[model samples]
Target: MSKYVIGDIHGGFKALLQVLKKVAIENEDQLIFLGDYVDGWSESPQVIDFLIDLNKKYNCIFLRGNHDALLCDYLKNGNYTEEWFIHGGKSTLDAYKTLDSVTITQHIQFLENLKDYHLDNFNRLFIHAGFTNIKGIEFEYFKPLFYWDRTLWELALAFDNNLKVSDNNYPNRLKLYNEIYIGHTPVTRINKTIPVNKACIWNLDTGAAFSGPLTIMNIDTKEFWQSDPLPQLYPNENGRN
Candidate 1:
């Protein structure tokens, strides 16, 4: 069975569908979605619905992203923040506007139940973002960093760029896994339109929340597929910008 890891979809339901169609996943194949399933586009509810349906047919692992956490927090406690609403949350809110209370509650449960990270038998780690302050694969506080930290990606990029002179000496957090797959930091931020590999960390978020395409990668072969750019798919939307 093939193992696949998909990047942040950010409510781009159509793009997600296109990428899935391109991959042509089978029943035996497993899919690991790297979170940020809601926000950005106009179909956040539909995205969650699709994922729920997908879980019925295949083995699916969904990680919680910062956006997802914010949404869940709002759903649970009605804690609304301006920052959350501005940064793609508005789109997500708009998407959920038509759903009934029961459906919204169910979606909240789905988001709340998402895992923060997943580790496989192959020594590959899948996380929505990255984790710092961990001891031997166990986190020592700083749990929110798993879905909110940018420093880990910065470190990986620094090492990749040869900016750090000591290549062999990595921080303890980076050493925990043989290969780490992350999605919070979009590769497009580095002017890359494709998945980026640096210091054994693979960044799968190709910025579907912005202008880039949604990406899906084969864990074993390192082969990948991408959807059309977000701007191309949804012509009028600014998409979390």
Candidate 2:
């Protein structure tokens, strides 16, 4: 069976479908989404429902993203605070409010149940928002990773390969666990730079909901697929991506 990894969906359900079509998913194949399945785009509900359905229908792995975490918090706390909402949490709440409380709660739990990261014995890892101590899973770091400054990663990228991420909030490269597949940091395109793996790490988030493009890459085959957003499909998330 072939293994696949998709970039951040960011609620671009339609675009996601298009990319899936290009990949021509096979029944024997397994697909893993790096996260950001909801939020940013207007189709948060559609994306969540699609993911839930896909997991039941096929072999798939979904990682929890910062946006997904905010959704869980909102469901339990109903605190639509500014910091979270400003990062696409507002749009998620708007879409969720349209559904009944029961369905919303179910979706929240589904999203929350997603692990902060996924790792296989075969030198592969799936993560969202770049974890500092990627040697293992750390759900507590999700918040900081989500709201973290990209400058940290940028600095890490610039320094020597031996650098490591410090526990005291200092930016050092802790040597990412495996060939990590992470999202949350938006890019103009499917840009990739592996500080340790000699280009094995892939940053697939092509910024679809940010008006850039949706990205999907087969981890085993190194095949790249992309689809641009439908016109105005993402006017808001377009800000940072």
Best candidate (score: lDDT): 1
Clashes of 1: 0
Worst 10 residues of 2 by lDDT: 190-199
Per-residue alpha-carbon lDDT of candidate 2 for residues 1-241, written as tens digits (9 for 90 to 100): 7888888777788788887889778888888887877777778888888888888878998887777777777788876678767676667777777898787877877876786667777857677755544334454454546333254345435545453344454332334454667677765532532112223355676666566667788787777787765335555444333
Candidate 1 residue lDDT tens string, 24-108:
7899999999999988998888999999999999999999999999888877788878988999999887777788999889898
Question: What is the lDDT of every predicted structure here?
Answer: 0.88, 0.67
RMSD values for the candidates in order, in angstroms, are 2.1, 4.9
In order of listing, the candidates' clash counts read 0, 6
Off by over 4 Å in 2: 134-152, 159-178, 189-200, 230-241
TM-score for predicted model 1 compared with the true structure? 0.94
* The best candidate in terms of TM-score: 1
